[model samples]
Target: MYIPAAFRSDDPDLAWQLVEDIRFGCLISGGLGLMASHLPFMVERGDAVRLVGHVARANPQWKELEASPVLVNFLGPNTHISPSWYTTSPRAPTWNYVAVQVRGRVRVTEDRETLRRMVLDLSALMEPDGSPWEAAKLDIAYIDKLLPGIVGFAIEVDHVDVQLRLSQQNNADDQRKVRAALGAGSLRERQVAETMTRYLGRLPE
Candidate 1:
């Protein structure tokens, strides 16, 4: 999260969009000697910004939240930029990517209704065209039986850090070369290239 001024993104809306686009993240807590859980998050924006997610009851990471704040890491498209791709010599190889880190206070909720809502909302987010499998379609008895196996939680965000290291420090020619190299590669590489082109406007119009 050590973002240089040139790489830092001060736009909260952009950060939120990144979080939503890449819903899966690592939730980390240090009170229990550094415990982390990879979970798919659902963001809520309103009077108080919150991240809602659930962890398996068997996973002890949620238990540590009681003693510590959590850091959620949302990593977007990334690629390795070779020095050879640059227009000039004497350039060091580096990485280009977009990432957002959210620091927040977490609260574990065990309420059955809340857990059910969280699950439904998460399903909606994951599904291609909204989930056809609504909780209302499921048997209440089955849902009740499954509720005890998981723990729902919400994190009230304290701060957010967004970084887009897309060769902003490079000159226009070098950046264009990097973008071309990346876009000519795999699908993921192409995505990183597109993001750089879109956000930094380094590519010619």
Candidate 2:
């Protein structure tokens, strides 16, 4: 998360949007010599913001939470920016991307109600339009049987680091060039280009 002044972002709304946009993140924890679990999370904002997710109880990472520290990192649209695309001569290649880190120690729980609500809430977040697996329609007996295998946790958001390196350091002409080049590239590149476009007029000249 070493972000330059040009790339650093502190907008809380943007950070939350990015986290929700890319719900999947790498939960990093230390003390067992560093462990990571890739999990889909639901962002909770109230008196305090927290990232909620779960993992199998057997996953050793869960057991280490109390003894270790934790943080979750989410990555958004990213693309490789070729040096050839830039008008600036003598420039090396670089990546244009968005990344966020939610830093806090996780409070792990195995309470049946909490776990149930977590599963339901996660389902709803992933499927906002509603689904056949909606919490109410789901079989309670089956859910109960399955709940024991997993543990839920909520990471209180103590700090957030948002990085938006969408070619902001370059001049306007070079930014346009990168955008146009990416616009014609793959879908992922197109997405990165779009994000860059959104920030164009808003960022300083």
lDDT of each: 0.87, 0.87
| Error of model 1, residue 2, in angstroms | 0.9
Q: Cα RMSD to native, each candidate?
A: 2.7, 1.8
The residue pairs found clashing in candidate 1 are none
Measured against the true structure, the TM-scores of the candidates, in listed sequence, are 0.91, 0.92
Model 2 worst lDDT run, 10 consecutive residues = 196-205
Over 97-154, each residue of candidate 1 has an lDDT whose tens digit, in order, gives 9899999998999999999888877776687766566555777788788889999999
Candidate 2 residue-wise lDDT, 65-90, digit = tens: 86756888899899899999988799
Q: What TM-score does structure 1 among the candidates reach?
A: 0.91
Best candidate, TM-score-wise? 2
Q: lDDT score of model 2? A: 0.87
